[model samples]
Target: MLSTKEHADVFRELLRKGDRLYLVPVPGHSSALPEQLAAIAKNISADLELVETYADVFAALEVAVEGEKKRAIVLCGSLYLIGHFLSSINN
Candidate 1:
């Protein structure tokens, strides 16, 4: 929805997390999001884990939440992305 790269900073702030995980989409699927979002995570700290699949994201979140570290998981995506993860869980 945006043509400029600088505007990503706003989302970057909103998306900041204790330890962020980026679910990078496959090539040609707005692939720029990986780098853009990762930059946001790096702006907060030196740690950023970029995983390529929904399962990896769920595993990471499970570990984080189970650790009792009070981490907030923010999922920002279209309904299709949400459905993909949901389907993964049901199978």
Candidate 2:
């Protein structure tokens, strides 16, 4: 539901506070953006994790939700990823 800028701002703020971020990558696609994000986080001294599967996504969300302090942001690469997440959530 958040715009990309809003998500980026949240990410920046989280990075500022030394929070861990997980960037879940869409399979079989270009990983340029995720890689760039990882590099940016590294530049700002933030921890970044790249996960690439449905199980990974579920696990990351479960951990973040259970942790209650940290947050996890899922960046869907294309319409396909967005649709998948949307459908899953709706169902």
Candidate 3:
């Protein structure tokens, strides 16, 4: 899952073994950086791989999909991020 700090905890709840949780920064907004979010998640003993902070969702997805098997990706958080993803695909 990819999310910002506002919904990080909720997204963390949906984590499963083998899942990767990606926390990203919300540009222009005062929120926890992705690194900080990862730290917080680790503090709580969140399972799964906590990859490094990615500033771009597409970049994150690219890395996430690099394996052999098919995968399911969930993009959650602000509507702006969702819209950004949608716009990116439509381009």
Candidate 4:
């Protein structure tokens, strides 16, 4: 899991590259509000996609990669989603 500062740093770097970023809010956590997240994206000039479920993240990444040929997926929200994806990839 990444610390808040690490996450922020990664987000900053990703934004500079203009990459499409998806943020899946962790269930039961509300510190990262949608509007705030969107505003952050807008501030950094990067596209932001909100994902409400783990499945949504997978589907979105698959569609973006297969349909749009995007090669990287930067998930910036929800440690649960991050663990899920990491476990899947490791397995």
Tell me the tens digit of each residue's lDDT in model 2 across 1-91: 1123344444455654545555555434443355455555566654444322223345546755664664545454355557656677899
Give residue 78's lDDT in candidate 3 (0 to 100): 60
Residue-level lDDT tens digits of model 1 in 1-91: 1223453554555543344554443322333355554555566545445323333346545655665666566655434445556787899
**How far is each candidate from the true structure, as Cα RMSD in Å?**
5.2, 6.2, 3.2, 4.9
Query: What's model 1's lDDT at 14?
Result: 55
Q: Which candidate number maximizes lDDT?
A: 3
Clashes of each: 0, 0, 0, 0
lDDT of 3 by residue, 9-78 (tens): 6545765665677777654455466786667666554566655679878887787778837677778656
Which prediction has the highest TM-score against the true structure?
Answer: 3
Task: Please list the residue runs of candidate 3 whose C-alpha ends up more than 4 Å from where it truly belongs after superposition.
Answer: 1-8, 27-31
Cα deviation of 84 in candidate 4 (Å)?
3.4
Which candidate, 3 or 4, has the higher TM-score?
A: 3
Report the error of model 4 at residue 34, Å.
3.1
Which pairs clash (backbone N, Cα, C closer than 3 Å) in model 4?
none
Best-to-worst ranking by lDDT: 3, 4, 2, 1
Q: Write the per-residue lDDT of candidate 4 for residues 1-91, one digit (tens) a residue.
A: 1224344455566565445555444443434544455455666563444322222456656655665654665665566767776777799
The clash number for model 3 is 0
Q: State the displacement of the C-alpha of residue 48, model 1, in Å, after optimal TM-score superposition.
A: 9.2
Residue 1, candidate 1: how far off, in angstroms? 12
Model 2 lDDT at residue 74: 44
For all predicted structures, in order, the TM-scores are: 0.47, 0.46, 0.71, 0.51
